[model samples]
Target: MSQRPRLHAPTKRLDIQGLRAVAVVLVVAEHVFAQPIGGFVGVDVFFVISGFLITSLLLAEHSRTGRISLTAFYWRRVRRLMPAAVVVIAATLAAVLLLVPQRAPQSLADAGWSLVFLANWRFADQQTDYFAADGPVSPFQHFWSLSVEEQFYLVVPVLLVTTLAIGRRSSPRVVALSTLSVGVVASAVLAPIQSTADPETAYFSTPVRAWELGVGSLLAFGTAIWGRLPAWFGTSLSWTGLVGILVSAVCITGQGAFPFPAAAAPVISAAMVLVGGVRGPTSGAAVLRAGPLVSIGNVSYSLYLWHFPLFIVIGAVDPSAVWWTVPLSIALAYVSYHLIERPCSVAPLAMWHRRERARFREALRPQRRSVQVSAIGLAAVTAVVLSLVATDRVRPIDIPTVPLAADATAAPTVGGEDRPALAALGKGIVDALSATSWPELDDGPGANLVGTQHPECGRLSPAPSAETCTFGSPTAERSLMLVGDSTAVHWIDAYLRLQDDGLLAGWRIVTRTAFGCPFIDASLGGQDATECASFRADTLDRITEVEPDVLVITNTFADTGVDGDGTAPGAAEWAAATQRYVVDVRESVGKVVLVSPPPAGQSVQNCYSVGGSPSACITETSSAWRSRLAALNAVAGDDATVVDSRPLFCTADTCPAFVERTIVKKDFVHLTSAYARKSAPALGELLRSRSVFEDTLVGH
Candidate 1:
């Protein structure tokens, strides 16, 4: 590694190299262990360092010449930052195309955004939800940090020049302080809100992160306050700051949405290190400046750039190869720094410094107009190249659409012959129910049957009771009640097929869309209101009162065994309530059929936005789904036959999101109406085989 020069002049040399080492190590540890650890605050540290150093250099130049050179400053920044960034991005794009699954189009889009420094916005727009266990993990996830830093570098110089123009008579320190104060206050105020709104973006966005950098800038421009401090005090503070940074890395995990309120740890620690290092040689400062630490600092930027792509590619090729691949990745990063990065950076710095010296001695300079024109030309070229690369990265594939074959069956005898009788029965039930009796189902629109007024229900006007929805033809032999939560309602379209084909044997299909309420009389207190509990109780009572021949109850088992917000249930209360409901349903219903809930999967909304067809988004082979079903089925004893849909919906290796070109779901978990209807033949076969419905009468 190249040795860093000791500062002889009173220039603002505040251990930027040491800070870079801190930033890169945090980022690496976060990725390696898959922890949050406020690793992203490393980017905040970088931003601050950039703002401080760049502003100081510009101010120094302006003081010497009485004029600021925007063109020269930008040129130097581009040469320093862009070469490595462009190389890394280009390499990442190639790796993405080669390694990522064809099913994951989002990876391609994310790569494209990274190239253009818009990854923060792209991630924000997509539901980069941290709560989901199996959400999309784009290889280019780290690009958001790079994008924010690059963006800050782009705009800060412009802002500084404008401020200097307006306040020509003001002291440089005063202007710097004013700028830092405004940035700090704005960032602190916006940080919490953005963190709440979308933490992934808040973590990555330059505007929301300006305060961390502003803090550093203020410190850089402010005269040394720590020179008067006792030597022991400075050393203690430095060691404490270093320890804080290390402790945070070891402790924090990446389970929830990140860098929100959690960002204070790394930001504060970084500021401490800056203060400690600036004060004079402390134990911690000496350690940071030591040979091993300085070597890591020299290669840290290249390490950060290379590690993610290496992990991604290795995982893509063989997810199980992490043990060997991780070490190999570190070795490769070290090699890349030595061979590619160190040489490139040194060559440019040497050439630029030599040119600068020659220009200084000659006392000759280009016209302002000529310099501006050259800068514009260079910018235009860079923009064009970046645009072309982005376009190529995100080009869409042409997938041919295949039409599904329809089942060959005519309309049922019930539609023509039993219509009058069914209509009369529906009227009779509606007349029996009071207007205030039925509760409005508060499940989402997709799950609410009464709200949607689905065509199969045959009620053009709203009905007041659960019985009203299920009132059969007077001549009907049996009544089939579709009881339970939204999953049961999803299968209603399938049951409607049986009804359409006269397989229902004049039975009525009743739907009770209680969001996640299991048929058991259990109360999810604080989660569901008293009114909702009552509504569920009343609905269950009505189902038992009507006494349907076959009761189909289904629910999504609580996978986490806790509420959506991750709070644990009161064990004694939950157990008692659950057992009571199970007993009650078993006593009241004649024959209960439990439909195993669909697997917890990625949201189809993100899949669609990323250009995946609906068919590509379904989960068929998730272990989470398998484990959930196993537990739920065990709870359902002999009284109810638990139907495992995994075999019907999924293959051994993969699940067909669309079987026979019919989409299995509208979203992640719920079935689409058309797909639900197509599933009727299989469900009908299951019902007949199990003797839940008589084969001779239903006519499979």
Candidate 2:
């Protein structure tokens, strides 16, 4: 092996390096090899290690000299972390353009946040963002952990400096110990509390996660205890700690989420190993110090940085080769560590004033060009960001051209393969298999035209001007109210066109759609379910007030889970709730129309390219989603109008992304506005036949 990095100098512990190797490998198994080992806990292990190392280094500096030099501390941190991070982020940005064009905007923002050490904040918001449903995971997603550590590096050193200065007469060790103990306990307590409100906050919040690092710092502070311990006892404790880390990785699955009680397992386990190692090699140090393990540890940071992007890009370009990405990621990591990480971080912080007894003043060698180099790096990142802004129109999905004619609406029914729109869509999917580029949209993926009705459609607060949402005719005596999630909103363009074709010349259309808020009264274990439950309650109240002649409801239940768990299949609970909700809507407005979600299709960004089988992309059978639809219909019984949407969008078992010139869906599931509008006649005819227009007919 090429000479291992000598960065750790005298303080280097083989066990710690081994732990890094173990942590990184577990993470790779989860992300690249699809293993269930709580590989994510590897990050928790890293946090503990970082906390231990950084805090020890700072305290040693204070002990050697009367004061700590802030400039020296920050400069070392910049050298160790920033250069490699920037290179990886830049490479990730380039990868986004080549593999997944649509994710470019999100990736750039992710890169920007990563550079500033605020990536945790950006991702926490994204998890709860109702509108950001377009892309796959960001390539720079792993940077959130690096961001938190960077944040730790910034605050902890300053904290030590200030606390030591104020309590000059008091024991510095005691003051440090007390202050950090309080911080650790406070952060540990806050984690579960934050998780109940929002798991993302618990997962990514710096304050909530401080305890993991705090444990490591406390271990460093308690170094005096290690010297007094009997050798055999210390070795036993080390062995137990090694076992604990393994148990943590194997046991802690996503039963809830992270950064709480579950995270404690790895954090404590890491501390145990480090504390045990302070005594001697009697611990599991012999195994940890193995050549292959130490080599992996040496390049661990580079491995962590390279693995995620490789996993994502390989999946996009040639999914068949995804299994082999591990070797590729490790090879790249080795190269990056040698070429970039080692070279940039040649000046180790641990090499503190080898010759001088007068430490702080003598060691303060000011490098004049450091600030200028930082400024230049910042400018380069900013330039790339601005370039992305300039080319904003180079997107994954383009503004659709409405191709379906005005009279093209056809309500889908079983065995309606001959229907003009349905047949065209079937053929489009076939042609798309070998065709490159986006399909020229005929009807939708249309831009929102009736903006007032849909403004902030996914919030608890309904639009104040709900009355202005009326379409077709001014002073129309009858009305149709559209309600539910974005699934319902996607069909608005079609309904508006139904009126334009003079099917309902005097009907006023009202919209009560919320973004991710399905029309269920109870919260499922889905993302933002509690908030969505509130939105559902508010919209239900408005439904009674508006009392449209007929209320149209649509939402995708694939994300939903029953027993208040989004991960579990709702099955009975889902259908039961839909049945009850529809009956309640009927009580308020006397009519309920259920437009079940269409089958999931391959996203337009992939599978719609040349030389790919439509079957390869659109392989998920409708039965998976339709099971929920069937449950909903079973509960509704004869009381509500059940629109079997399969006939409209599918020809047999397959659902195509495109039909003729019409794009069936703008995203993974929602219909294109043009297709919605083009299919208006069919939907109108079905609704009319089901007595939806029984009361609101304009007999002029």
Candidate 3:
């Protein structure tokens, strides 16, 4: 009666479900076991499959009706995805609040973004920021891929429908193929370039990932040609596809540029299987359709949703409990599919096919369905709010107030025993964590110390002249120049305190520092490396011009691994640079004082924020310090004084992150204002005793 071909109901493809199972397994195995580097390619496999299936369905619908219903398409997506997603997010939020309260706010923010399908953009922003790079991983980080998929799906139907409607003279298949090809080619061309430049952002972005989906759409449109291929040829294609997936899973890792040529292995391979097995079974298809594989694939969406948060929670408790999490995730996924996904899928399907008013009245029942969906969504929101309220209070930690002794003024010299005051502070740190209640350290001071007091003086990308700030005895006749990166900036508080104490009476201290740059001439490449090198050259020239009475230089001097060559500087290279710098300084500056790097410790803000004990954050100065000392000591002539800061920050084998109520490093390596200022007396005494300024009067 109608001009449309009689379309058979879409049959369940056991092979596709098996592919889903394989993808989920690969993802779960990669995440849980930290092996089979290509396990992440499973995401690519899923993307391609989604593209093919969605395109095929849309094409089939258009052929039957001559037009596609946008309302039905979007409603189907909502019913199929939203219910399970909402429940899982709500549950994961509750779990995060209870177990990892430190990450509650971040998790809530991620969940909010995910609800609106913008999680990918959020992660992309975070990846671009160097400062936020080192923050702890969020359990919901995997939602980025879902966000990308959702955004792609949202645009594809609209694009295809518009093209089909506007170009009535062109064949629908041709129009769809042309539109999809542009997206595929454009994305393919851009992906490698973006991946090379900023792989972190490229990996999480939607535009860069569009090619994989577009390729799958191409396959769907080309089905007529592929359906006529020989069975033996199909078998070969299937085998090759399976092998490609397996090889990629084994070989690819997170270390290198990704989601381009590497991701192509999985995307193309999955496409081969889809195209090759269109009309008949191949060996790959047979394997995929196995009962065990199909069972897992049947609920792969829910499985993907549940696994990551479970991994994060279980990992926090026992990092090696992947055996438990993997199985638990599978079981929970099965339960979720039965309880939520299966029931939610029915309404969308039932309401999808209504040609007339009577049919719509009989079948749709739209108002009732809307009410039910809204109720479920509201319940999810209420549950999330409850979880947030339950964990609203910050866990309190007892910060021990270690009393400074009457003889706290004693400063330890090189190779001399550590001051008794430092020893007392170490004891207090150990005692503070010994209590039964493991509460978070109140980080009000440490949190505000970095930006509020120091501002952008040592941020990643800094303008040299703008970041340069004056410190001690500004109008004094003698000027002391502090030079290096953040490590140098850390000592500024101490310099200011010494000025107040008149330990630096005649000296006006000028701090010239950048974020991650050392004082050495050799390139230490990072995001800030070029600017740092430029700033370093300018600062050195300034030293020559100012010819300050004291040129005190210091830096972490640690190998920053983000180089253009992809290799960080070793000790030998560092030593060579140090020697070169010292030699240059001797020719220009009147007095060159090299301040040794402070004993490194874990991030005090992170440790305290996570409710970790002070003792847990303690670290020993590594043997690397000895090598650094050897290099600096080699270059030290009578004209240069090398001051070792280990005794000031550590006692023998142990280094505490906190001294009294003063938190040491705000992050991992930079010193906090309070601790830096408190250690000024020792630094002041060192500079006063060993330098040409030794004869200078000690202020009252």
Task: Give the better candidate number (2 or 3) by lDDT.
Answer: 3
lDDT (tens digit, per residue) of candidate 3 on 368-417: 45446545654564465335423322222343333224422212323224
Q: What TM-score does prediction 1 earn?
A: 0.61
Candidate 1 per-residue lDDT, tens place, 20-94, comes to 787776776566655554464566566655666666677677778976788877666565555666777777777
Better of 1 and 3 by TM-score: 3
Best by lDDT: 3
TM-score pick, better of 2 and 3: 2
lDDT of 2 by residue, 1-700 (tens): 1232343355257877888898898888888765754777889999999999999888888889978899988988888788888888888888677656656776788889989889889988867321123435567778888999988878888888987777679787788778878888999889988866677666888998899998898888877778578777777777788788888888776545466878989888888888888765444456777778888998899899988887766555443345656766676676677566765675434444443323322322232243345445545644653354224223232212232243122223322333444444444544543333444544322233122234454444444356555566646677778887777777777778866765665677888777666777665564566666776776778887777777888877665443464344465676676677777767667577888776776555433323332232333334557677667667777777777675556544445566566666765677766677766666665565566666543222
Candidate numbers sorted by lDDT from highest down: 3, 2, 1
Each model's TM-score?
0.61, 0.74, 0.71
Measure candidate 1: CA RMSD.
Answer: 14.1
The lDDT per prediction is: 0.55, 0.67, 0.69
Of models 1 and 2, which has the larger TM-score?
2
